[model samples]
Target: MRGLLLKLLFSLMLCLFILGTVLTAFVWYVFNYSDDRPRSSSHPIRKNPEADPSGVCKECRENTIDKMVEIHSHTWKKQEANFKKFRSQLTSRCHGATKAIVTQVNTPLESKIVYDGEKRKPLVVTPKLFSTFLKEQPFKNVTWETCAVVGNGGILLNSSCGEEIDSAHFVFRCNLPPLDKGYEKDVGNNTDLVTANPSILLEKFEGLMEHRRPFVESLSSYRDSMLLLPAFSYGHNTPVSLRALYTLQDFNSPVQPIFLNPEYLQSLARFWRAQGLRAMRLSTGLIVASLALELCTNVHIYGFWPFAQHPHDRRPLTNHYYDNRQSKKTVHAMPAEFAHLLRLHGQGVLRVHLGQCASGPR
Candidate 1:
């Protein structure tokens, strides 16, 4: 009986080992070798000249490249002209109001501050210095006003939006995730600023330095146009990855760092509180810092909804993006704030483009 039991135990262990090995291999294959083709055969393939011009035959490829270049150059010139006009309009309307608003919002907060362990200091520009920075060198000739904000929706795949997104005077991307593999066709190579809060940097980079190489390689494709934004407070987010990113200047594509003044944040918070809308004040610091980039002109926003919407329907969620999926009862939605954004867009305060979705969340 004892001999029989020992044999059975050995057989069970062998089976378990085989199962684990097979599962590991399957995961590795999925992550490393999966193709970008649609999972279902029912989905039809759309012909995109930029993605695959072979449909037109190989001989005309040179013509296609030349046409793309010519189109980009013309669009760039037109965008510059529009940006200058937009800046003039903005200055005429809001130049005085903005300063008064900033002063009114200014409040002192007794909060401790911390920085990532990286050696570079934050790039905090005073109003005058920021304006000067925008006016100098490369920007003197290049106009960077009105911008179109693009999101990473799969809907944008083969949607003929690459040129439209690129036409923006300044384009913004958050989290700086790679556009390689599955996303290359969606997010083309024309990103201007890579935005992040310190928390995002810390979470993605700390203790995961091995991941940095691929991220850096993807970003190197846009070396000349990387803009980094700092978090407002340690309390909002205190991620170790932020420090890791700061230390990664050795990566081929180093980002130009920009810091937000804590005072600006405190002031914004005070203003929101005075309005009796303290709950909506959490991200005010980020908003104020972003607005200050009016010096850069033609600011457009993307992927900045307060909450994630349905993956297919693009409806807003009541809970946060990272919330547990199993807990259905606890989830709640916030449409009022989204309505406010629409109102602001209508007032020309900011341009907010919704991703293509047939319905919004109820």
Candidate 2:
């Protein structure tokens, strides 16, 4: 009877010990893992710098790269913590690293490229045109530590971001904007890749069918930068794209003209559409920024403001840093695209510089 009593007492003590262990674990989890507790230095509140209610763009004005990652909010803290996951979530659909441009490998001689603008019209890869394609993607098997996508917004007129922009491992520009002509200090002279719209060829150089010297001379400033053209985006873009390429070849210019793959573009459009971007077409700035997000470990976008007033000082601005010629609003949803970029900035996936840049290497 004494042995039975001792066994019962031992069993009761064991139950109490098990209950005590479970309670201790519950308390530990509440204190250590609960959101109410203070986050470590590694995780921060993912706040939108633009949406800061204080009227001061404190986070946006930071000159140092380390300071740029400080603005966060609770909603995006998880995304801010896992950049690789965010990048994969964004790029896995478009695959810009492998398929951003047309290559002989990606576009075989007989394959057809459906125009993104006119879905019914498709351009077959003829042997003559296939010869112009690079053997592989220029960005294939390459990743940059940092990248800069420079837009033409007039907010950059005197931002003095050149030194910082030039410091990036790779730089992307849109619409073949002039890099020289005293604009280098603000816009930078380094151009790893620049996009030229077909309309620019038709309007600026008379389709490159006449005064080819001026066209060739204008391209001299790019200095071996790969020129990307939307050759198959629309049916009308094909001739001018080809003309621009042929002109470069005829002059033996160092600037290499490449074609934007329509397939990749379509995929990108679908990706953006899934993200709630409904526009007639994605702007050049957004396209390059998205590409940068995929190719670079750290992506910084400059001059992306779509407003008429300065983001900081509320001063009037031009449509572009180089010229005030306004764009056709019906084509692109600028505000909507900027909203998406702003969200990405909030999530710590990328940094969007709306005001003047800090004058130095970043």
Candidate 3:
């Protein structure tokens, strides 16, 4: 009877030991390898985008927006921005609008236009070239209540933000993005100003040296919007920018081509550098966003995401909304630039739109 009781006790002890070992292994796996960790009240668990492939999970969206209230905010709330203070800072630091565009008044008949990118090279203004300059700055006497600076990131793929974007008093776009072929519903038709990189002329239009008619037709989509060109930014850009102006004028298209002041661009670069942004050059998005903050009372930014995967869905995204082409990683420090915008969004200086827009207009 004693041997029998001892055997039963030993068996029970072995079973308990086995169960405890199994439980310890599971706990170790979960804490060390698996995605389970103790959470502090200050740092909540971040939602994994991989788990929500459909991106329609409303709970994740709400939690993302509610918890961080920065980059992943699915909802946009208009905060009472200290417009005067912010505008004052921009003006004092960069003088953004003072010489925003190169005009006949700013560039003299024989003035040397220093290249912003290649500071050593400068373009001398000739009489014929001087004629293309706008008589004065654009929107000088007008006031814009709100402005939209639209980027071309694929985050805007299905975002129905077109109506809300068009409702802004002024709309600015980067890199002369296509606004047609079923894209107008998402990107909007209004463009008060659009920047045209010199590369576009070289790549898309073949330097405008031949087949100029195609270039003329492309301008039809912008419909009288000012073509902001960095004509003096590089030495090679001058000829092509001049050609674009001549093409528009020859065709008698309402679209106007204007040069961006290199000096203003340099100052703008310094302004951002002062804020600790160290990139080869500021991406066109950041430059335009800074300009919008100074030019308008309220600024709203769209499609500024720089990640390869969707913030909420983890699906692959094209570099741009219109194409799957990737950007040159070495050219721009995009992620770092986006971080600056995120800070601005947090401070209520600007509104960065993420996720899809509401069904109805704002």
lDDT score, candidate 3: 0.82
> TM-score ranking from best to worst?
3, 2, 1
195-223: candidate 1 lDDT, tens digit per residue: 55555455555533456675555457566
Q: Return the TM-score for candidate 2, rounded to 2 decimals.
A: 0.77
Candidate that scores best on TM-score: 3
lDDT of 2 at 38: 75
Q: How accurate locally, in lDDT, is each candidate?
A: 0.44, 0.83, 0.82
Q: Which model, 2 or 3, shows the larger lDDT? A: 2
Write down the TM-score of every candidate: 0.46, 0.77, 0.78
Best by lDDT: 2
Q: Would you list the clashing residue pairs of candidate 1?
A: 105-267, 145-298, 146-298, 201-241, 202-241, 202-242, 315-361, 318-332, 318-333
Model 3 lDDT-worst window of ten: 63-72
The TM-score that candidate 3 achieves is: 0.78
CA lDDT, candidate 3, residue 149: 90
Candidate 1, poorest ten consecutive residues by summed lDDT: 99-108
